[model samples]
Target chain A: DVKVTQSSRYLVKRTGEKVFLECVQDMDHENMFWYRQDPGLGLRLIYFSYDVKMKEKGDIPEGYSVSREKKERFSLILESASTNQTSMYLCASSLGSNTGELFFGEGSRLTVL
Target chain B: AQTVTQSQPEMSVQEAETVTLSCTYDTSESNYYLFWYKQPPSRQMILVIRQEAYKQQNATENRFSVNFQKAAKSFSLKISDSQLGDTAMYFCAFGPSYQKVTFGTGTKLQVIP
Candidate 1:
């Protein structure tokens, strides 16, 4: 089975602090995605990388950015953490574009106070 | 742009019974993919089932099946013999390709023991 691991399952940060949520996948998938899930709004894409060092902005990438230094690891960075940034962040990876199914991590719940 | 919609915000089912969750999507393309993902209390998102647009036959995995209506643009998930472990937040997603996936608002399901 494929395994996707997030560095932290829960995190707390103060306002104006920078936050990092890390995800690593063992399947060596070529595509990785970051999303924030909020009640009533569902899961909105933040950023996605088709390959190492490649990234694309999704519907709601305003307050977030991503880094993919290696093919197996994808990291989401919040320049300045705000209360509004508190939500569940999910990471997923797939073998290729549209052909393979996604394998997701347990998710990171970040709380900004 | 493609969008997925799950009108049902919450649902309940008694153990050993059957329940269906509704999902609808809008897309301009003729070929794409649809998926049903379940997130349990542990927050790990699991792929419950999937269906391809090119295939007319509905996809089924064990007791989980999908009712895919191309003309109506509807994709509903049916769970038979509901168990306590079946309780989770179910999300419907759509994507033209694997680059990005757009998810619905999600439906919270509670399986009664």
Candidate 2:
């Protein structure tokens, strides 16, 4: 079966600590995305990469950055984690074109103290 | 950029009943797709159903179906004979025939016995 694997399911860090959320997909898809999910705001895109070594900012890209060094791996980075940055992060990948049925990972829930 | 809107924040329905969740989107693309994604409590997100803009027939998957009004730019999800397992947060999404997709604020649906 196809899968998107997130390296961590839960993480707790200090306010100023750097955090990394890793996502690897086995589908060899061209498009990978990072989204932050919140209670009332739903899922807001943080960043997405259409190809390796390429990335684009989404609506809520503030305080976050992403890396796509390889086709199967996309990593989300929180340079300095803040309390407000604590939320469920989801990773998704899709084959580009009209059919963008995203395969998602079991999200990583981060809590900053 | 395309934008999606889900008017309902929370909704409930009795078991064996039917419920409809509304979604609207603004897009200039002639060819695109609409999707209904369900995220169960403490679980991964999954695609429930999708509809292509070029198809006139509504897409159905067992108890789930969509009311796709291309002219109105409205895509609604209708769940028939709702069960307790159907409780989840439903998100409405719009994607172009390319590599981008936009998600709405989502509706939390509760199925009560």
Candidate 3:
């Protein structure tokens, strides 16, 4: 079976702390994405990488950045975590250009105090 | 730019009954894909159904099916014989073969006993 694994399932960080969320997909999908999920607001795209070292800002990318050093690994970085930034972080990967389907990891819940 | 909308934020259905979640989207591209994703509580998010833009027939998976209307740009999901295990947040997503996918706010469905 295909799998998308997240490094942390839950994390608690202080305000202004540097945070890192790592995701790795064994499916060898070319496109990887980072999204922040919040109540009522649903999932908002933060960043996505179509190829290694190629990243694009999604609708809500202001406070986050991403790195794709390898085809299977994509990382999300929060330069300065804030209280407002606390939310469930989801990592997803798709096989092709179309959203044929997105295989998602079991999400990392980040709590910024 | 592509946008997806899920007007119903919350819905409930009795066990063994049926319910539908509505989704609408706006996109200029004629060729794209629509998808329904399910995220159960603290569980991995997975694809429930998907429909190609060019196909006239809707997609289905067991008891889960989609109602795809191309001209109206509306794609809805129907759950038949609802079960408690079906309680989850459902998201509608849209994108073309070469573009980033857009997601809606999502609908939280509760299957009552």
Candidate 4:
């Protein structure tokens, strides 16, 4: 079974603090994504990486950034955490093929106070 | 820009019955893919089923099947013999080849005994 592992299951951070949410996939996929899930709003993409050291901003990339230093790992960063940035963060990886299906990690729920 | 819409915010079904969750999307691309993803209470989002735009036959997986209407731009998920495990948030998603997947505001389904 392919596995996408998120470093934290739940996190609490203070306002203006720098935060990091880490994700690693064992499937050796080329496409990795970070999304924030909120009630009623659904899951909005923050950023995605198609290759090592390559990243692209998604629709809701205003308050977030991403890093893809290596092939198997992708990281999401909040430069200055705010209460509104608190949400369930999901990590996913895909093979980057025509019929690629995203394999997701167990989300990390962050609460910014 | 492609947009996915799930009209029903919530639905309930009795155990061993069937329930269908509706989804609509707007896109100009002819080659694309549609998917149904389940996010359980554990917060692990998994792909339930997927269908390619070029395929006329609907996709199915065990108790889950899809009603794909190309002309109407609709893709609905039908869950048969619903079980307690089926209670979760179901998200409808559209993905164009080599593009970010767009997700709908998920529908929360609860299975009653």
Candidate 5:
């Protein structure tokens, strides 16, 4: 079975603070993604990495950045955390195939105060 | 850009009954895939079912089945013999071969006893 592990399950940060969410996958998948889930708005993509050192911005990438220094790890960084940034962040990985069946980690819920 | 839409924000079903969740999407790619994911309160997103655009047959897994209408761009999930364990948020997703997957606003489903 594929395993996607997130570094944190819950986090709290003050306004304007820097925050980082880490994810690691054991399946050696080539594609990784970060998404934020909010009520009504659904899960909006933040950033994605197709390969080591390669990154792409998604629909809602503002105030967020991503790092993919290695194939197994992907990190999401918030430049300046705001209350509006509080959300459940999910990390997922998939093989570089047409199937696109993703393996997702338990989400990290971040709260900004 | 590919887009997925889930019209129902919340749905309720009696235990042992059936419920259908609606989803629609827009994409220009000829070969694509559709997925239905279930996220429980634990926040772990699990793949429930998937359908290939080129295949005429709908996908099914245990109590879950999909109604895939390629021409209409509609993919709906039907849950049979709904159990309390089935309560969760269901998300509809679309992706082209080896590309980023776009998710719809999820529908929260509740199974009532």
Candidate 6:
């Protein structure tokens, strides 16, 4: 079975601190994505990488950034954590196609104090 | 811009009964894909069913089936003989020409015994 593993299931960070959320996929998919989910707003895309070094900004990319040094790993970084930035973060990977279904990891719930 | 809508914020059904979760989307692109994803308490986004816009027939898998109205841009999920495991947050999503998939606000389903 294809699995996407996250580095942390729950995290707590202080304001102004830097945060890193890691995601790794067992499948050799070419696309990886990071999204933040909130109540009533659904899931909004933050960043996505099509290749090892290529990245694209999604609709909600202001407070987050992404890094993809390897094909199987994608990382979401919060430059300066704030209370408003705390939410459930999800990582997903899929084949590089519009119709390909995405495989997601168990989300990481972050709380910024 | 593509937008997915889930009018019902929450729905409840008795166990072994059938339930339908409503979903509608607005998009101008003719070639696209629609999906219903289930997110349980574990917070893992699981693909429940998928429907291709070009296909006229609805898609089904086991106890889950979709009512896909391409011209109306409505895709609803019907769960027959629902089980306890069927309780979860159902999200309707749309993927247009771009690879990014946008999800609806989600509907929380509760299965009562």
Chain B TM-score against the true chain B, each candidate = 0.98, 0.98, 0.97, 0.98, 0.97, 0.97
True contacts kept of each: 0.78, 0.67, 0.63, 0.59, 0.75, 0.63
Better of 5 and 6 by TM-score: 6
DockQ of each: 0.74, 0.70, 0.64, 0.70, 0.74, 0.67
TM-score of 2: 0.95
Expressed as tens digits, the lDDT of each residue in B4-31 for candidate 3 is 9999999999999999999999999998
Candidate 5: tens digits of C-alpha lDDT, residues B1-113: 88899999999999999999999999889988899999998868988998989999998999999999988999999999999999999999998865578899999999999
> After aligning candidate 2 to the native by TM-score, how far in Å is the CA of A26 from where it should be?
1.3
Model 3 — TM-score against the truth?
0.95
State the lDDT of candidate 4 residue by residue for A19-104, as single tens digits: 99999999989999999999999999999999999999999999888899999999999999999998999999999775858899
Ten contiguous residues minimizing lDDT sum, candidate 4 chain A: A94-103
Residue B69 of model 3: what lDDT?
94
| Top candidate when judged by lDDT against the true structure | 4
Residue B18, candidate 2: C-alpha displacement in angstroms: 1.1
C-alpha RMSD for every candidate: 1.0, 1.3, 1.3, 0.9, 1.2, 1.0
lDDT tens digits, residue span A14-108, model 2: 99999999999999899999999998888888999999999999889999999999999999999999999999999999986538898889999
| Residue B110 CA displacement from its true place in model 6, Å | 0.5
> What TM-score would candidate 6 get against the native?
0.98
> What is the lDDT for A79 in model 2?
98
- lDDT: worst 10-residue window of model 6 chain A: A94-103
User: Which portions of model 1 show Cα errors greater than 4 Å?
Assistant: A97-100
10 residues in a row with least lDDT, candidate 2 chain B: B93-102
lDDT per residue for candidate 3 within A73-105, as digits (tens), equals 999999999999989999999875545688899
Model 2: how far residue B89 lies from native, Å: 0.5
- Model 4, residue B3: C-alpha shift (Å): 0.8
| All candidates in order of DockQ, best leading | 5, 1, 4, 2, 6, 3
Give the residue spans of candidate 2 off by over 4 A: none
Cα lDDT, model 1, residue B22:
100
Q: Candidate 5: how many backbone clashes?
A: 0
Model 4: fraction of native contacts: 0.59
| TM-score against native, each model | 0.97, 0.95, 0.95, 0.98, 0.96, 0.98
Instruction: Identify the runs in model 3 with alpha carbons over 4 angstroms from their true place.
Output: A97-99
Per-residue lDDT tens digits for candidate 6, residues B1-113, read 99999999999999999999999999989888899999997769999999889999999999999999887889999999999999999999998743589999999999999
